[model samples]
Target: MLSLLIRGRFPSPAVADVGAGTGLLTRELAARGFAGTAIEPNDVMREEGIRRSDLNFPFRWLNGSGEATGLADQSADWLLMGNAFHWTDIENSLQEFRRVLRPDGFFTPIWVMLDTDRDATVQSVDRLLADAIPSFSRHSDVVMKFINSLSTGTSDFSNHRVFLDSHHSEVMSKERYLNMWRSRNDLQSALNPREWEAVIKKIDELLVEEKVVLKLRTYAWIFEPEEIPH
Candidate 1:
């Protein structure tokens, strides 16, 4: 999916994966032969990503955030955020991206959501979260709205087009899917200890009853930089 986004943008794309956690996206790009850098603000996460990365291709791990990447001007051909754009300061990040990207660079933000409608267990888990954490669905909706709004061009970026695409799905075991939920800091932080326990218990039960094969949906919003008069 990511390769498809950067295919024709540059002969050898110099990519920056902002907010890259554990270098998942960075490693993918490197494996595909992209000369790339992974910028992460958290020391622990960044170090872990570096430790886990075993790519033979060129890649750099940096201590940085989307708002302040500390990269050279016009140095990157493509900037990508995989499931981490929501954590960024959008205005500052957009300005920083504009500064670091070449004139023709592309910015793509991607996310993966559990396809709740496709599976009863997934819907049950969604309902459990909705009941346990009031902000779960609301926050998700807000993020979606903010991402959608970016298509109109933000104050800092006046000449860009955001092309939205989705419906790409991947299959995984129920246990792996549940672990993905457990890894979410947002959901964990929102619930009290007892509520968290109850939610997890219910999710486990549902997974067992429903036979636990998850269909995960991937969504990408590709922002193309275009010429605009000031």
Candidate 2:
């Protein structure tokens, strides 16, 4: 999605992956021939990324937060946050993004959300989670509200124009899909040991019994700084 959007916009763009957990998106950009810089605050995740990285085309890794990237002014052509924007102080992060990005640079926040309404299996899983964790719906609602703010340009991005786009129904196998849910921080933190075990067991049973496959939706909220009149 990002590659397609930047196809004709910039030639060999310098990309910054802020809050880059395990450098997944950073490596993807590097593999696509972009000059990439991954800024992560967590030492463990950063080290793990380095350990797993292909040394042939190494990208720079820095200890930094979204609110203070520690990058040179106007150095990046694109700044991206993959499933990490909601964890940031949005106002400060946007200001820092503007400071580091070139005048023509773009800022994008991407998220992959399960399309529960369209998939019966996902809807069932959602209900199961809700029943298992009382605060699950509240936590999800907060995140969704933040996402909506970004999509509608209501998050105090006064100097930027925001465009929303989504690619729906990206398929994945049941095992891979369950792993994705298991990896979520909210689920990990919210569930106690017994509850977590029960939830996972139920999920496994449902997936196997129903032969479930996940259909996820990818959402991108693209922010472009508005040009000042000469």
Candidate 3:
């Protein structure tokens, strides 16, 4: 995903990563030789993002949301919003993305998720999580709604969809995985203590080779305006 976004692409283009959270994506963009602003709604997360970022890379952090990123019109070369898309007003965000994106720019919402549908371990984990948390939902479920929104969400801008892909995997030590799960404000907001613990226990018990094996795939929906009258 990182390579596809940055491959052969000059660092002169600016990227606006809405709902950027702790700047994980922003840092990745920086490491890829892009200079951009990370807009996060939460002050704490924005601060942490700034602290963790290497400012020498021309990375900037700000407090904002998907609907109103506080960026100038046609200011961003790329508007990449994901991870926190479900937390946003879909329709409003789509409009905002179009507004901030340059005429020739791209807007893509990217997802790096476990291969839940194809991988056995992922399916087992998903089932247990769905059972444990009554409100639990899969990544695919949310993506469908996002895909639908592209056509029906806004009338102001016509979106031309393109498929771009990437994949990778990593082994997660129990301790590291536990910390990640616990640190996610999104999950913490949705899962209670029991539901959360149940998930941890399930994953811990299902570990492969004493660590969680994640077969990950990156998905992106690149949006291009059908016509940009400049």
Candidate 4:
């Protein structure tokens, strides 16, 4: 999506991952040769990022909020928020994003979502998740009109592009499938020990009895910055 929207065969030179949690995308950007800075306010999430990181990439982690980043003015060529933009004060954050971006910089928000049309089995699994964890239903909508309105439709934002990518990964077995469910933030917090165990047991019974893997769809939204008035 970045490649298509930016219209460049290669990646950007420098990027700042705002509200970056666990540095997942930070390291990915760094691995692509972009000098990346991860700004996260939560200490536990930041620590988890550091712990999850390879420690080889030059990822500078900063404790900052999206509304007021500690970065300098017009410093970044690109700003990225992966699955973390919803938690920000979007109005102020977009203003701050414009403040710190160069004249030709871009602000891209990437979200990896589920592909609902792949199979009936996948749909059934999704229903199970929604039933076991109601928040899953709410979290299905990652980007909303109000959230996009914060940064988009402004004179300062430009080259607005939205890309949808669908890739399929097959979870070999029921245990692997259950692990994916267990890793979800919604299920992790919503379900108690016994409840989680029951959910997992139910998943195994469903998947093994039916025989299927999971399908996923990823969506990415990229926006280039227009030159702000002096």
Instruction: Quote each prediction's TM-score.
Output: 0.80, 0.83, 0.76, 0.76
Candidate 3 regions off by >4 Å? 1-11, 130-140, 148-159, 180-199, 226-230
Q: Distance (Å) between predicted and true CA of 177, model 4?
A: 2.5
- Order the numbered candidates by lDDT, best leading: 2, 1, 3, 4
Looking at model 2, report the run of 10 residues with the lowest lDDT sum. 221-230
The local distance difference test score of model 4 is 0.70
lDDT agreement with native, every candidate: 0.75, 0.76, 0.71, 0.70
- Rank by TM-score (best first): 2, 1, 4, 3
- Writing each residue's lDDT as its tens digit, candidate 2 over 60-158 gives 888999999989999988899988889988778878888898888888888766665677887888899888877776355667777777545465533
Native-vs-model 1 lDDT?
0.75
The per-prediction tally of clashing pairs is 0, 0, 0, 0
Compose the digit string of candidate 4's lDDT tens values, residues 1-230: 46444437325556789988888788777766667688998999999988877757677888987888799998887888887776777668888988888777878766665666775666777788778877676465545443355346642333344454557655566666677677776666787888888877776777644435566666565665653322
Backbone clashes (count) for model 3: 0
Stretches of model 1 off by over 4 angstroms after superposition: 1-5, 55-57, 130-138, 151-164, 184-195, 209-211, 227-230
For candidate 3, the TM-score is: 0.76
For residues 144-228, could you state the per-residue lDDT of candidate 3 as single tens digits? 5564554553433235443655667878876776676566565556777886777787777776565766677776667553342
Error at 61, model 3, angstroms = 0.9
